[model samples]
Target: MENRDTETYPLLTPLNHRQQNQTTTVVFNAESNDISPITGAGEFAREFLVESKKLWYLAGPAMFTSIAQYSLGAVTQVFAGHVGTLQLAAVTVENSVIAGFCLGITVGMGSALETLCGQAFGAGKLDMLGIYMQRSWLILNATALILSLLYIFADPLMKLIGQTKAISEAAGVFALWMIPQLFAYAMNYPIQKFLQSQSKIMAMAWIAGVALVGHTVFSWLLMLHLGWGLAGAAVVLNCSWWFIVVAQVVYVLSGSCGEAWTGFSFKAFQDLWGFVRLSLASAVMMCLEVWYFMALILFAGYLENAEVSVDALSICTNILGWTIMVSFGINAAVSVRVSNELGASHPRAAKFSLVVAVITSFAIGILLSLVLIIFRHQYPMLFSNDPEVRKVVIELTPMLALCIVINNIQPVLSGVAIGAGWQAAVAYVNVACYYLFGIPLGLFFGYALDFGVLGIWSGMLAGTVLQTLVLFIMVYRTDWNNEASLADERIKKWGGA
Candidate 1:
């Protein structure tokens, strides 16, 4: 049956043949066209090898960059944890809740560049990449200014959400110190996506590595040695992020990105409304996903032993976040592959890339799940010393493992949606699955039934499972040729091609 489908569709073809001008001409000249052909087990295996190499070529540096970048915060959290329980809760709350909110918005808005720049690059309209990035910077900076208000008023907001006075006050102070990091997010995400779209990720990885190392050194010196506590953690973290942003900007300006980094353009100022619309849709899609887990932190804060519950949940979420960086790397790679293929008018290649990415990410997810389960008892010691917090984390290990598995696949699918310019559609799915269905069910389980954190997580995991299934079906049934046409239309509409 698989062989029959392969022969009938003939989507998996040699990379060399697909790159030929003849194939490109045929694809764009025809209203409907089939991709290059492949036959036999040997040919199929060969194509698969070629596709995997291309996927990992991008994924490798992307993953390392993501992990190193994410570690900036994770390392800060570790430093905060050793300070004291109240300090741990405050840093976690500020990082996961306050900065997290801005991250979702800024990063999500920046993802609009992934779609635009990837397609534009594949379409060979490299000039548009820089323009699109500038547009994102403008939108995100404006967004950063507005979101700074959240930091300014974080204390009242946390209290309004039923947090204790102590945690609220500490977290609010931490939020103020983090205001610099928020603007850094605005600049960093767009630059990262811009570089990724052009496969210039190794530079990002190097920069992030440097930043992480510097962060660790400064955090140790200021937070621990000098005894500045949370203030020191905040200072180092903010500086580390800005270091990354500055390094990336310097690289782009150095002409290392070639055509993709054309000097600042007045053209970016044009078509402001259209860019904002797409950016808003992208923001909604990502914010829904990011803020979903964030809600767990919020809910955990309301439990009977609120500090312990919040501490354990934050630790669990932190661990989950580290694994998420791996998946997000795969996500970025697949998005680039799919969008590049579609923009190049190779629908079958786009579809084939999706198949390979899913298999690869799912396998990695399984491996990571096993590792987590094996180390479940020992890993919490890295984040907290409290006996109660460690005990609660052990109790939640099973659910955390399950979340790790599901999250691996979900982000890859969301990447597909972004690559195909389906942000609005996926945003609706997130709302239905995460908010309409998941949150309500979690409320019933956590509060009404008294299952506490475990019940709330289980309910939320159910929603994630449902969302993943829906996304899988969506991708499986996608008309790739139609999507390719849509990609062409998008590029033309944006004046890229």
Candidate 2:
């Protein structure tokens, strides 16, 4: 009745084909080496799990390293704050404003190595990582020399920017004392990018962790016990940073990053201009994003009730900056993941990696936002005892929470662009949306419309919206296969595998 002719023919099932011609039934077992056919949904779920595991492996260590190093500066400020309000003002301006600016430039310049070393490693040209890092040193050190002038003249710049004379002079002295740290920053960033490309992130994490512990103890000793004030705090913080750098250098030379770090060569001096162009794009894109937030602080200072507004906004910025570092770590992870897959000629894998990274980071962002909202009133006690500042902070918490979510998503997308070698394009988008449109809108809302700090913040958020939209479109329209082909050609052009 059930098609006896076909039954007699015994539809030759592929699974049972090796069996005798007689009718046979095959059953799949979980313990068996053979895999049964999977449904479409099942395949997707499986791949998603695999990709999530891979992403977290890279992101976890990166986040730890980033937060630990970030704390070095934060800890110095804490020590200085306990010294006196004047000392706190000096340390904050020097560390948070001027140094933060130089940091953006240095770190952004080093990230070009992320693209290069990442692809080179993925293409099995391990030795190039060392050359790439050495090249970064040559470029970054030269850049650091130019940046040293910024540290040397911090007082006049602060004064010109309308900072109080007393605070500006003190901060300037503090800035020059911290100048040695600039070279440390220059050396550290490239090495971090190089090792990260090779999946050696744990070394960076552990080194930073150790340096942070040392930083805390020394901060207490130097700033409090020794009563050395701002100068002592700056010196200790600089030493703490260099400690991390020295440890990283040891890790590379100890053969932990073998092959990827063949001894440094003069060849790093070759084709320098091409590296500079890309490095400049990376720097511009990053600085646009970094300076955009600094503008928020600058605008907040002029709003009505300037005292409360600035204090509340500064507290919010500190928390936001700390949280954004998590997203930054995830950004680094995704950049490495996408670039590596492209370099390895696996376009689909690159696409999958990007998807996994965004989903994972977005989920974390949501959790962070929820926590910030829930604890808005309570957490202000960590940084402020002033009742008025706390109230204002609570008022602004919701907007800040939402922006936290956006911060997480946008950086990961930027990382995608970086992996795809789209820095120059993203730089243009950032400048247009952030400087040309966002800052002006914020100024209009805050000053002309008299909307105060919230108005200014809303404008900054609008800029983020435009920048994120452009990134989405760029990433959406990308032909991954073509990008993979381009990565292959790039490696060959660089004399890699």
Candidate 3:
């Protein structure tokens, strides 16, 4: 092993040496030299242990933060359910359809930061993290302005899609109240990816924890106690998300991020066109995935028993959302690891990290799936008390459990693609598998075959399974060494290295 000069390559502490101008070479042989079986096995164990520790170090906190933040809406929905099934369905449509559309775009656009910041941090180009974050914020906020129109017109749109008048009108009112959350999404995602790149997730977790607590208190006071109803829920939800945004902003400005927060600059504006293009690709990729499921809710609204179908589907999706958060944590962790290692010219390390993360996340998915199956009958009570809704949820439990397992593995692969800056390619894959193939199959089963909600979900799950397999193959065939060189080039092109 070569000795590294800490001053020259401060972030590559674990790597043996730094690559200069994409020309310097470092050898990393994967094959074991030891002839003794015992010695090789011992070395492999140590390596696995070390990688697992590094993965969980980031994943544990990231998962907690994701769950805490996601719970804001979940908690609101729970409160709405207790208010009435009508209130619950209204909130569900607004959330799953209206807000969900904007979330897909904003979070997707902001994910461009994950690629930029993760690689920049790995390459020891800390200053680029702040600039990339700013660039993402600009694009996402502008996009939010356009998406606001959706919230404004959610009522008519819901009705146009065959939703009941009562549900549409109520959901529209809730949608209007939740517009502030759109902008909050714009700011929050970039800040998250920015901090995530540098492994500054503990602060994010803390902030989210505080926000969830504050949100619950205010939700109780305004919604239940003060009789604010949906209005109260919306108000508290908006405040809680913005609170997170403001808190993260304050943290960044306080100089806690060192070189990564050298204040704002004009550089954020320098590469607007280029940024928009990547942001758009990312937006499309994520929008396809997020909207794919949002379609389930939309389709459910057209069912005979619209309210019951929507309510029950919403509950299943909510449970899926919670489980997805855990997978997303692993997704974020693996993305950071891959990009950082690639940026630091450690191809072998990046590949190892992906393997470990996939194994860990898949195991978690299996465990959660089993738990949901074991307690399937009881879990829907948390979201609804209506017998019809509960019965429908029970009927859907098997499909939901299968979704949990597939979705868990899917996000991890998506993370790998994101880390490798393969958003453009993945966007096309999502289109083919989700829209062209999955949605049509679902429509056929759900309507043509009269399988109902179960049929629709089964079709969507098939798409997810196919998409997951495609991503798995893409990851399997990736040439890590070539990817490392590409990361170096991307750093130089964008980070001015």
User: How many pairs of residues collide in each model?
Assistant: 0, 0, 0
The 0-to-1 C-alpha lDDT of every candidate, in the order given, reads: 0.86, 0.78, 0.86
| Model 1 residue 358 distance off true place after TM-score fit, in angstroms | 0.8
Give the true-structure RMSD of model 1: 3.9
User: Looking at candidate 2, what is the lDDT of residue 162?
Assistant: 72
Best by TM-score: 1
**Tens digits of lDDT, candidate 1, 146-200:** 9999999999999999999999999999999999999999999999999888888
Where does candidate 1 stray beyond 4 Å?
Answer: 1-42, 494-497
Off by over 4 Å in 2: 1-39, 304-308, 492-497
Q: lDDT tens digits, residues 47-107, model 2?
A: 6676667677788999889889988887776566567656766776677678888888988
Q: What's model 3's lDDT at 115?
A: 86
When sorted by TM-score, best at the front, the candidate numbers are: 1, 3, 2
Looking at model 3, residue 224 earns an lDDT score of 83
RMSD of model 3 against the true structure: 3.7
Q: Candidate 1 versus the native: TM-score?
A: 0.94
Please identify which of the two predictions, 1 or 2, would achieve the higher TM-score against the true structure: 1
